[model samples]
Target: MYAFKKSLSMGFDQAVEHVVEELKKEGFGVLTDIDVAATMKAKLNVEGRPYRILGACNPPLAHRGLGLDPDLGILMPCNVVVREEEDGSIAVVFMNVATVTGLSSAEGMKELGEDAAAKLQKVHDAL
Candidate 1:
């Protein structure tokens, strides 16, 4: 699959809360929240399913990556998402942190990304 998925028994709000809590434990802080459902409705006048994009970041890791490669800001703030399935289940997912790091081609970025990926995986696993 192109994405990582974790199903949760909790409702949408509760699932999001759990994700936030878990992310914090992993040293990630949410920097942005994009409510795709609401944005699409307001911008395009079209209706769609529920979806959200959360921009997450670990300041120390980000700083290290930036110090190694000055242009790494393009990949800063990892993304996490939460959405409702058709069957009323909630699914939480995130970008593979290691994958983004690999895109940098910087010497130390791979290891940094791998460590971030491991933490993100734990967040998903907790859900």
Candidate 2:
């Protein structure tokens, strides 16, 4: 799969909070948050799941990647998602960093992706 996912037993909000703390412990910070359900409702008038996309970044790794290729910003922050399932449980997911970052031609990006993927794996495991 292109992502690492875990079924969480906690409520949606609590799962989001737990994910943030776990990511912090792994030296990552959430740089952005996209509320998908809200966006879909406002833009398309469609009902959707309780979904949030979190842009998580490890600054040192990002800096290294950017230094190799300025255009790497497209792949800078990794993505973590918290979405409510039909069963009312939350699913915490992380994009497979190496897979997504593979689109970059940055010199050191492969290693950076590996390192970033490792951290994200830890975050997923913590859930």
Candidate 3:
């Protein structure tokens, strides 16, 4: 299994909305939204199931992580996902903050990642 997976059962749109709300509660904001399903359909003329990628960021946490290690920005914001399963269930998933930010060597960044991971886990659990 990949290091960055957490799943919650919900409708696709509802899952996305819930994640956005939960992330906001954790002081993070959705900065980017890419509708994989729509994009693939439009760009590649390929039909696929529903999927989306959300880029979330918390400014204070980002600042803290960057302060610890400049290069940590490469893994900043973390990615959250929403996809429809074959069984007609929606699964919302997010990057494991600890795993993704662990790529950095800065201890402070690691700590920040751990904190963020806790918040994200809480959000997932709430879902």
lDDT of each: 0.86, 0.88, 0.82
lDDT of 1 at 120: 88
Off by more than 4 A, model 1: none
Residue 3 displacement (Å), model 3:
4.1
TM-score of each: 0.93, 0.93, 0.90
Among all windows of ten consecutive residues in candidate 1, which has the lowest summed lDDT? Answer: 1-10
**lDDT (C-alpha) at residue 41 in model 1:** 97
Which lDDT tens digits does candidate 1 get at residues 1-127? 2257788877888888889999999899999999999999999998877788889999998899899898988987889999988988888988887888788888998899888888888888877
lDDT of 3 by residue, 9-126 (tens): 6677888898899889888899899999999999999999899999999888888888888888778667888888898888777788887877777777678878988888877877
Better by TM-score, candidate 3 or 1:
1
Model 2 weakest lDDT span, ten residues long = 100-109
Which candidate would rank higher by TM-score, 2 or 3?
Answer: 2
- lDDT digits (tens) for residues 37-125 of candidate 2: 99999999999989999999888888887887788887658889999999999998889988877888767778878988998998887
Ranked by TM-score, top first = 1, 2, 3
Q: Model 2 residue 11 lDDT? A: 83
